[model samples]
Target: MKLPSEFIEKMERLLEDEASRFFSTYHEEKANGLRFNPLKIDRETFLTLVPFALSPVPFCPTGFYYDAHEQPGKHPYHAAGLYYIQEPSAMFVAEVLKPNPGEFVLDLCAAPGGKTTQLAAMMKNQGLIIANEIHPKRVKALSENIERFGITNALVTNETPEKLAKYFPGFFDKILVDAPCSGEGMFRKDEEAVQFWSQAHVEQCAIKQRHILDCAYEMLKEGGILVYSTCTFSPEENEQTIEAFLQTYDDLELLSIEKVHGIQPGRREWTNTNFEEMERTARLWPHSLKGEGHFVAKIKKTGPSPSWNGRYAKPNASKQMVREYRQFEQEVLQTEIEKPMYAFQHHLFALPDHCPNFDGLKVVRAGLHLGEAKKQRFEPNHALALSLKPQDVRYSLDLSSDSVECLKYLRGETIQTGEDRGWLLVTVDGYPLGWGKEVKGMVKNFYPKGLRIN
Candidate 1:
């Protein structure tokens, strides 16, 4: 738990008296947290069903503090996407954004999708959310987390901020720029972050964040809300960054963020210009709060920007593909998918409401991936299973969380169920885990191999 000299020197000058409390936190164990997916399960029900010692995070209603000793990540419920394991303070970012249902939201720099999932839940899986990650490799993890959370309205993409600005200018109603920064705040949770720490890196991050923010601003509609946040405490990446953004854009207004639950305000003195309105930003210090550090700033687009003029995604499924899918839907699903269905070669997807065409964009996933249509048959995807309720399916195989069969299913192993039901929705205590197809008495495991617990 050795602190870096440069980091210590910079912080001591910034804090003066409070530096000791902030540095003392480095010796403490990192905070552990999990936020229940409201789309999958309610908070009260989740508390009753889960097997763990948990306490609620005061800042975030959905977030719960799990003991560091607990291995909730290995639990079958995790595979089922019942809850997302996230850092406690990191969960607060989405709460500040507070995206409502039926809104077009953008999660700029979304990787490993903690905030994206939370924003999806807040949106109630209704609106369009583009979770963009610049890194090609990290976007896969973001896409996977989006699937596990049963997010039906997200379009996972791997593209630069500049690229997205071109396609979605003035389109999104709300946006989250969870800007990448020097991992000053997360050093406790990830020791690697401490090793990577340097003053030079912090300056680079500040420059990069400004560039990312400029792109995010372009996509937000006039009068739209945009939340900028970071996991680091560096003034260059926090108060200073927000001040610079405000200075650059005359139309942007720094909106007040309610400071509760031991949260503090941004120091105006930290900024080069000593921007007075910078105090509207909120800071979650580890010493002040029960969680690790974070900084958030909510802003509104006051000036007019050109509205997006793009074609909405049309139903492109062939007549034969439609007929085949409809037949399967009739036989297996009790609910109807009334949304626009699009096809990419043999793969079928139910397009989200008001989804725009992502032509030429590097889309990793587009809306709810229904599955592929091969020949005359349509295979249901694991995403299709996770999004369903027990009643939505014609038949199901329900298993206990700790049952041998549950472990088998998570491990991508098949089981004998003695049922002839086709397209079975496998559940862990009534929450949809994944899909399994029945052939005679053997239920073939369709749990995605990439996600196999093995």
Candidate 2:
């Protein structure tokens, strides 16, 4: 694990006495962590269900450290949206944001959705989370992670920060800019980051981060919280970037981040102005914590903006489609969808609370995708199955995760259940995995082919 000489040289001069400890950590195994979905399962229940040996991540309540040898990602529970495998230090970013339920939040530059899902969990599926990513390809992973987490209130979008700022315009109560950086903190986890590390790249990332933060500021409401984070330790993207941002926006105040569990404060001397208040930001050093590196800064917008006067998403479901969906819902679901229903042609979706009309945006998922109307019948989507509780569905096929049948289900194989009950939710230990429609004595697998365990 060879590090760049220049990076090491700079760090050695900066740390001086502590540089040895930091460099020594590169020879050690990288830490692994997973955070459970509080929206679906509690911590005690998750511990009882999972077979892995785990330890608590001190900073994040939902986060746990798993052994590097363990393969939680390959488990059936992972498909069931039970937990997210994330870097322990990366989990600390969302904890700093602390989005509340029913608040309009934006996760700018969200891709492969680690922090976005955590923010969704904190919001408890009640708020509208506009999870936006710039790259088209990366946005797919972000949307997939959101779906796998059983998140129903998110509006996954593929759009640029500037474009989103134009559409939203001071609409969010809270925002998270987990800006793209040179990946200094992620070097241990992703080796490519190490290969890409350079001082010039760091400067470019800082410029991009400032532009993104400007977009975030435009979208955030007065007194709203905006958390800026990076996986890099470079002062150009951390203390210096925040310092420049605060200077540019006099109304934006840097709020103090409570540093605990070996978390350190941002170095004030790292900035151009040697800003003393820059110490309010937090830093997660690999040598100081159980995880790799990260930097987080929480700020507040004290200035006001014009109130968003956008139209809410209207119920566009036709009478026939509504009737068909209701018939399916009544026959299969014990609970009812109480939100406004919208239609994308034959597909029906229950819009999130206070959802603004995203008519022309590149929305991967609008809201809780109810299902699609095929001919005269309503076929429920896999998203619907994952979002449901076992008690919420009328019939289900519960299989032990260790059993061969569970593997078959995950592999998209039909199960031989001796029940004629139709539209059944398949579960692994009472957690909804996917949809399995029962016909005669055979249960047809509806687990998505793309997600099938080969």
Candidate 3:
């Protein structure tokens, strides 16, 4: 990979004797880290379910390190939505964001939904989470993952941060801008990333990062926290971008990140700029930590705002769509689940509030995900399906290990269950996997395909 002339010169001065070594070699260590999905199972239960071969990550309480020989994905617990595979450094941003239940949060660049899912788990599926991704292709993957993880509080939106800002000015209590950047940090994992590295690309990404941060700032309420993060190591995309943003928005102030054991803070000085006081901003170097390169900075919007003429315009769903959704909810899940569920757009969602305003923002999903009703029985959806308690349903299937594995892996035509007839909530060690109906000594599978263990 060819570094920009200016960047190379800067690295030469910064590294001095070690500059050549920094450029010549890449860190190739692969560490497996998994984030526990609190919505489906508690931390203790998740750890107990993990195979003994995978070691626990020492620094982060929720993160675990898997051995090279282990296939963590094949485990039944994985299909049960017990945890998610994530790089250790990538998990830090969500931990620092620390979203609470019943708060409105936004993930401006959410796709594949790692952090967004974590936010939902943290919120206990109670509050509103707007997971926005501008790219259309990635939205499918994001939506599937959210369903697989049984996240009910999330609403996916496909729109740029600029457009989103116009719809939701100061609407969110917490906003996370995991901005897109030149793949500097991912170069070790992906060789092609290094080939695309150039001065122009870095500068271009830095500009986009600034725009994303600006949108995040505009949408966050006063006293709200906005976390800006990237998977790149370049100062231009990291510290400098943040420094520029702080200079532009007086209402925003850099807040300190309480240090974790393995993570180090960002450099105090970069090029001509000094960030000594911005020690709260963190940088996880692949060389220094068990994971790949990443940067995180938490900033709080302070004081009163200049009242912009922006208001949230509620989304008007057609009466026909609403009526159909209500009937579907009433027939399938209204009695089966105790939570308040409603329909927004074409999707049904369950929230703490009776009626939520779905306005200018494009809402991909709205109410509690009651499984689609087929025949005379109601099937449970993957969303909030795993979180159901045993007594909440009329029937449940208890299957053997092989049957459970086959059902989880989506490889079985029929599952043997003790229940002769009636709908049964399938489970592994008391954690609800999903719902299944038993007929003639066989359990009908309802596990969503995207969520099925592969």
Candidate 4:
């Protein structure tokens, strides 16, 4: 747990009296947390259902503190999209934005989809949210998490901030820029962060964050709410970056973040010019809270944004594809898919409401992936199964969370179902896990092979 000597020296100089308290936190075990998905389950129901000993994260209602000894990731409920394992402090970033249902939103720099999922849940999966991650490799995980959370209204993209800004100018009602930074906050949990820490790296991250914020600003409409957050505790990437952003845009106003439950305000003295209004931003110190370090700043755009002249995405599914899918839907699903259907070659998707044309962007996933059109029949995607409830489907096979059948289903093993149901929704404790096709007395496992446990 050795920290960089330069970082230690900088912190000691910066904290003065509080350096001892801050340094002592490194000896403590890192906290583990998971947020129950309110989109799938309620808070009270989740509390009673979970086996692990838990405590609520004061700042986030859905967030719970789990013991380091517990392995919730291995549970079937996790596969059922009941909850999302996330850092407690990281959960607060989405809470600050709080995008309402039907409002267009953007999560700039979203990867691994923690904040993006939370934002989508807050929006009740009604609004269109574009979760953009710059890196090609990281965008895969972001798309997977969005699907696992039963989020139907997200458009996952792998594109640079500059590219996205050109397509979505003044399109979003709310935006979140959880900028990449020097991993000062994650040093305790990740050894790589400790090795990567440097003052020069912090400065580089600050520059990158400012550019990302600029792109986010262009996408936000007038009276839009934009929240910027970082995992690092460095003032250069925190107070200083926000100060520079506010200074650059006279139309942006820093809004006060409620500093409750061990959260503190950004230090005014940390900036180059000692920006006093930097106090409006919030900081989650490891020593002061039950979570890792984080800095958050919420702002409002007062100036009018240019009208977006982008074209709305059109339904591209052919008549034959629609006919095949509709035939399957009538036979398999109890509920009708009322949204516009889109086609990507043989694959089919239900486009989110008011979805803009993603003609040039590298789209990882667009809206709810319905399924793939195979020959004369249509096969449902695993995403379609995860997004459904027991009542949504015509037939289902429910297995207990602790049952051997549940584990077998997750492992991509065929199970024996006495009934000869064609397309059956597989569930763990009444929660949809994935799809299974039953023929004769044997159920063919449709749980995605990539996600199947060994």
Compose the digit string of candidate 2's lDDT tens values, residues 11-101: 9988889999999999999999999999889999999989999999999999999998999999999999999999999999999999999
* Candidate 4: residue 345 lDDT (0-100): 94
TM-score of each prediction: 0.98, 0.98, 0.85, 0.99
Cα distance off (Å), candidate 1, residue 109 = 0.8
lDDT of each: 0.92, 0.92, 0.72, 0.94
Q: What shift in Å separates residue 45 of candidate 4 from its native position after superposition?
A: 0.9
Kindly give the stretch of ten consecutive residues in candidate 2 with the minimal lDDT sum. 305-314
TM-score of 2: 0.98
Q: Give the residue spans of candidate 3 off by over 4 A.
A: 1-13, 17-27, 306-340, 344-347, 351-356, 373-379, 400-409, 416-420, 450-454
CA error at residue 167 for candidate 2, angstroms: 1.1
Q: Please state the error at residue 93 of candidate 2 in Å.
A: 1.0
Q: How many steric clashes between backbone atoms does each model show?
A: 0, 0, 12, 0
Best by lDDT: 4
Q: How many backbone clashes does candidate 2 have?
A: 0
Q: Report the Cα lDDT for residue 305, model 1.
A: 88
